[model samples]
Target chain A: MSPKSVLLWTMQAAVFWLVLFVPQLIVFLLVSNPPTWELVLMVATGVVGVVHTAVEPSWRYRVHRWETTPDAVYTLSGWLNQEWRVAPVSRIQTIDTKRGPFQQMLGLSTVTVTTASAAGPVEIEGLEHEVAQRLVVELTNTTQATPGDAT
Target chain B: MTTPAEVPAGLPAAPEFTEPLQEWHRLHVRMLVVRPLNEGVAMLVPILVLLFTGNGEKWRLIASGATVAMILAFSYLIWRTTRYRITEEKVELHTGLLTRKQLAVPRDRIRTVDLTSKPGHRIFGLSAVRIGTGQQDVPGTDGLTLDAVTQQEAERLRLVLLQKGTAPRAVASEGESAEPVPLPESEVISQLDLKWLKYAPLSLSGLVAIGAVFGVLSNYADDLGLHPVQDLWEWLFENPSLALIAAFLVGLAVVGLILSVPLYILQFWNYRLTREPDGTLRVQRGLLTTRSVSVEEQRLRGVDIQEPLLVRAGKGAKLAAVTTGLGSKGESNLLLPPAPLSVAHQVSRDVLKVGSDPTTLRLRKHPFAALRRSMFRHTVPWVVIAVGLAIWAPSWAWPIPVAILPFAALVGWDNYRSLGNALDERYLVTRNNSLVRSTVALQRTGIIGWRIRRSFFQRRSGLMTIGATTAAGAGVYHVTDVGESHGLALADEAVPDLLRPFLVDSTVDDQAERNA
Candidate 1:
């Protein structure tokens, strides 16, 4: 993942955890005043957060190395384990670039590659507009020249 | 790109071809009439009930206004939806006055051309010309309606479109060669004989009755304070043995009847398969509203022959074909629904002209590796369901175990049976299916991508599922049952050989195939 992608993934994880746990915390505080079990649960959550922060450095390093590969582009990511798909520049049939509200706000674009097969599409998310356009042109040119090179 | 105006004009359009555009049958009016006639009575019945039982000027005014608006809207639609234009390069269809939507389909993309004159169209001397494309949409929805056209004109247009590509070549052939290959006239493959068509009219009626009964039952339940049937599902599961036995018998009977009915209708319903002069297959059917659909030989994907355990005793096997174009229904794209195995093979070889090399046929079966992979992916859910059910109700726990065995066995067998793949220099054929056996053949040039996936358990078992995706639709053909090594080898050999030219994976191609 790119540094930007790692940041996005981290944000997503933080948001997801907050959405899941924050309401429960609020409900507990409102309903039960200073309960020992609630206090213990709060402390456990804090410890988990600390552990997550501690592991972030190694994850960031791996993400940077994986994302910066010049040979292909990787899009999708996972939390504990990540799924990194790299498509060589030549295999792409069509490249569609899209900008959603959030991505547009952040000056990022999503690129979708359509292969001739029926397996649907593979998409790479969170690339700068100019970078995505350049990649599409480069891949299209390479694909046209070496059509048979894709596996 | 040439601008629309700058494009060079060709031959002169002769006097607007004053021939009737289509048979003068009022198809739109007929459709409008049927829906209202059939459903009007139901709508009016309730109103009539209210009018008799109670009195309200407000209701009367509302009903009258609604009826008037509906009539006006229908009339406006029918009046505005009249016009068709035929151009040299494409067929133009115009409809919807408010929106004035115009659809132009290039003659080249059209695989089949069908003309049908329903009773209304027939009486009006109007005919509807339906053009079928590889796109997934209702076949007859986009058609040209000619209000007045002679049979001769219809035939002329059909011949023109059918022989469009032959003219320049024909002239050239006349000058250079003494004998040009004559295009074959209509070659009838099979016909639905009337005897078979009559078997399941009663069965269809039975289904209608069943639907009506269910509707009434649901309506009654809604009227009363009872919950929907979903709530009663728990009661059925409470007695597992009784429920299972009842479900099995009913399901078997229903399935047997459902299958028999369509086959019966197809057997009788003018089900003639004819090969046109242009190497297109045309199937015409329906007693009341006779419909014809043509498919080009090039669009045919692959032929599938299935022998279900029940039908295995018979000498004949069911035949189906995967096509690039969707069927009239736009759901299942398989053509030649359950014909004889011999007919299927002949159609495959002669009509489709697919190569019969052992390599191609051998490549057709699902790789055994896929079976292990799919089994692993699928087993987790079944195990979870079983455990959940067992935990939910201890009394019914024994039945959960029994159900899981058959579920796993069936899935495993299906995954195993579905493995097969075939690839030729020109075409690729792969066969796979769980319940409905299917074989898909695709031209080598048409494939977009190839995918190989193996789960953690599948890797351990040395199995992987190989899938090929096509642009025609999102239906992927997968070879499911194979050993891991065999699967890997096949993927390594086939993906690069077939799709590499189309694939741009410079990184992986340079590196060796990953064993995992």
Candidate 2:
């Protein structure tokens, strides 16, 4: 994982905290009824958010891995309840690449692989842009219903 | 300047195409008439209520007539605008007045053709033709339909769209030549047996239908100026207790049977499954609104026999076709109507084209930890609720927990009893249930992946959940709360060599399972 990806994650966390905390702070100030626990919660959330946004990505990078076989594309992801997903090459209906403004700034992209499974699509995030493009090409080729690739 | 038809887009580029494109076709004029009638039928109840109560009020009568007229006018307008064409290469549709939407789907990509006619459409001998590619159409459903066409036209369109002239069943290689076209023949595998209706009330759908009826009644109570359930209570309060109770009992019995019988008849009235000579399965069912669905035999992965709570009690189960595109539409996926277990097996075997039923595998029992995990899971919530209530209310709350304990225990015990799985050469059979027992006979070839999950609580109990990832049936068929080693074994065995690379020795995982 890129160090910039972690930076991007921290910015996202900061924005989320601002959106949530700012509203609550405004409400409390209007009422003049801020509780001590609210202040504690605010500090706790910030400290946890710092640890999560700054440190969690590298740990996540440890558990996350993706592989492709002739028959399927496998994704192993998650921190707590790890999930392993496999989308078969023959069944792959669509492959798409998404680059959010922040992700574009960070030079990262998320590749979404969709199949007929009810489990929903598998998204491989934090890929270097060049790698994401190549992945899309490979998957798109597979999705075009030509199964005779000797590769 | 040359016409577009003269342009040889590459003579042999389109393998599915042999002949040239057919001219564009518009729906029958009856579509304009039938479309409004369908909408009018939906508003029938409200109109009936108004007519019965309004006593010829001028404004009320005018409002009803105007609503019907507008609907009829709009249907005619849309029907006039819609057009569809069948080319050897693809099926193209041009629709919309203002939007000017055009959709073209290649012939090989055409997955299923559904022909359904509601009572209103049936009156005009029309059926709604939905050509689904088994994928979500971009923007809207205009990509895949002719709203209402003549029944004969719909049938002819279905045949034209589905015909694969030289489309190879096997992987196409270079230098393959003119394969002779075969004659079209259909063999009926299973048809609706009225005897199956005995199991209809046993289906959970009936109870759900009854619930929906009551819900609608309650929602529209004020509008209708009547609340039947509330009225019954008021009458009961005014009458003697024993006689009223007897009357209520009789009334409930009659209402339940009346409500369920018609629903069953309408749903499975002419249910039939047939196979075409060129490997296609067709299903036809329903009464008032008849439906006919055609699915390629290649798309069918397996069969799912679902025995809901009531159905299981009566030894009946509903059979559904497990296919790739068949996932989104639920009821139309029925391969077999709810019937005796013996009959369900017979139908399934016929559908699978095998002499023996794949579901009849001797399933291996789950480990004892499975039972322990379920018991602990079921018991904890009620126990916690009971204790909390006792602390708050002291006397009365204690009895609630006591009353709930045995039932929870029974449920958890039954859950354990219901869990079993067996892996044979061809099919992976897994059975799990508490209230509704769903035993799925999933084809091994259909399974593309395996998912092994261990939640915090499950890890503590040295148990895990394993499921097979398939394109068919709910995608994944899970075996929950099995011992960690056992679950891993099942996952490993599901698609051999696939999970082997991801997993280490079961002993190492069990240690991590214990730690977690």
Candidate 3:
């Protein structure tokens, strides 16, 4: 697991929690006489927020391990249920590295591997620069060496 | 990154050719003069019309002055924007006044070079050479305008460019005799017979009909007071079960289709296709303004065979090829319109180099699976529509459901009949359609990714859909109507094994060579 991925996951968790709870908190504060239910909800949200922050480090560690594993890059992400996409390194055609302002601030980069078809390029976000470059070089060499390698 | 290297100096070296500046200078002057005159008339016509209708002098004066100013601006821009150079490897064009823009196109990408002369240009012996790559955003802008070159020189240039392995040289060095090396002509496997030409116009009419309907709708909207019509349009869009509106639209479509038949037939009256000596196919068509398009064999992505319901009844199929170019109207890259089923197969084998294998797998038709899948996808929408109509108007609810049944049944029948897939060592062909049947050929090397999808209900029913993706274009080919085990087996085993031979490891030509 790269240190960069841990930072990224922590950032994501922070953003997610803020987006989910901030508006509700603002609305509760705006009310003239806050109801008993609103008070209870606010306390519950505060507890959840504290728990979320505490668990974030471990979550980041799990995400980092899942991202860097060489077996297959599995994507289990969606609102309703996780849709698993397992693409082996061999099937990858080209690997592109990109870093936006946010990622650059966090000293992280993203690696996107594109195949021939247009379902879209599979992206693995938030990796250390050196690790990303190494992965790209290694994949390219392996793909070139093995003929008809399907991952 | 590779450095830009000079073109190899392997062929017999010749003196560089320079374009005559006199012709371009004359062309520039003529364009400057004619452009203003045309603009003046364009401006004058509206003012004259307004004057006859008793419009105010203030409006007329303002319009005329604005038009004159626009013409002056355009002419000045054209006069300032004139620079061109001919190099050994490419043609360089420099145009623009304040901020200059330069464009360079290689001679190799040029498929056809056409020299056209309007009445005025004809008198001046100035012809515009329209270069077509069949991939440009604009139709004729990719070519260059030669000012006053002789017809003989233009012909010579065209011949030199068209000939394989012959490098383009300047027209000024005609006195020095250069040997024209003779290259073996490409063998013509087959020619377009009368039968093939007859079907070429069917798809064209379909396009014209669609265009006409849109034109009519726009015109109607303008006549009905644009703002009010726009508000009405928004209202109509929000309402789903507007039968009267749908019926009116269907009527318009039928009328458009009817009126477009003659236009298509006229356009394709003298359709002809010839195999060029350089192993490229050249197609020439059009009645009033003749146009020619050439497709290189190597650029062909895949051959598509379509069997429309009517054509299927007559035992005929339409054959086309997907190529790497922008098609007419920036819609599709289908090269051929329609050919006989047998001829399509033969051309696919010869021109596209798609070899035939006696052991090629036959298409498997899963009728039950197709029916169920189609019912799930297509019938559900219609049923929903019916239910919505019932809820909206309780009085007509019973009749709406009865009316929707036939539509669902027809859709399911079409899906069951049309869904089929054929697999071989090199290619995977899937054929499916509701109204217009389409057979897609995907080379193993061409496939980039694939997915196997199964819903909870589908998983219980032992049915799944496998989708294959390709870089050539969007639209996943759904290998629908397969049992769960069969679909999983294909995704897990057969597909990878079948594609293994032609994947990134092997070259495209190697498979062709093996098949040959």
Using TM-score as the measure, the top candidate is 2
What CAPRI grade goes to candidate 1?
acceptable
Q: Candidate 3, what DockQ?
A: 0.19
Tens digits of lDDT, candidate 2, A1-151 = 4446666666776787677677766766776767888878777776776676766666666767787766677777766566676666766666888988889888999898876565546778778899888888888876676553111
- Candidate 3 ranges with C-alpha deviation above 4 Å: A1-94, A100-108, A114-122, A126-129, A139-151, B1-57, B64-177, B183-254, B308-316, B327-332, B339-343, B346-350, B353-361, B366-370, B389-405, B448-516
TM-score of chain A of 3: 0.66
- The lDDT ranking, best first, is 2, 3, 1
DockQ of each candidate's interface versus the true one? 0.27, 0.30, 0.19
Instruction: Tell me which of candidates 1 and 2 scores higher on lDDT.
Output: 2
| Tens digits of lDDT, candidate 2, B105-212 | 887777678888989889888898888664532323423778888887787677667766423332253233244233344789888888878876666465577688
Alpha carbon lDDT of residue A63, candidate 2?
69
* Deviation from native of the Cα of residue B336 in model 2, angstroms: 1.3
Off by over 4 Å in 2: A3-18, A32-62, A68-72, A88-91, A118-120, A134-151, B1-21, B47-62, B136-143, B165-185, B222-254, B327-330, B376-405, B504-516
What value does the interface RMSD of model 3 take?
6.7
With a 3 Å backbone cut-off (N, CA, C), the pairs that clash in candidate 2 are none
- Which of 1 and 2 is ahead in DockQ? 2
Candidates in order have lDDT scores of 0.53, 0.73, 0.55
* Per-candidate iRMSD: 6.1, 4.4, 6.7
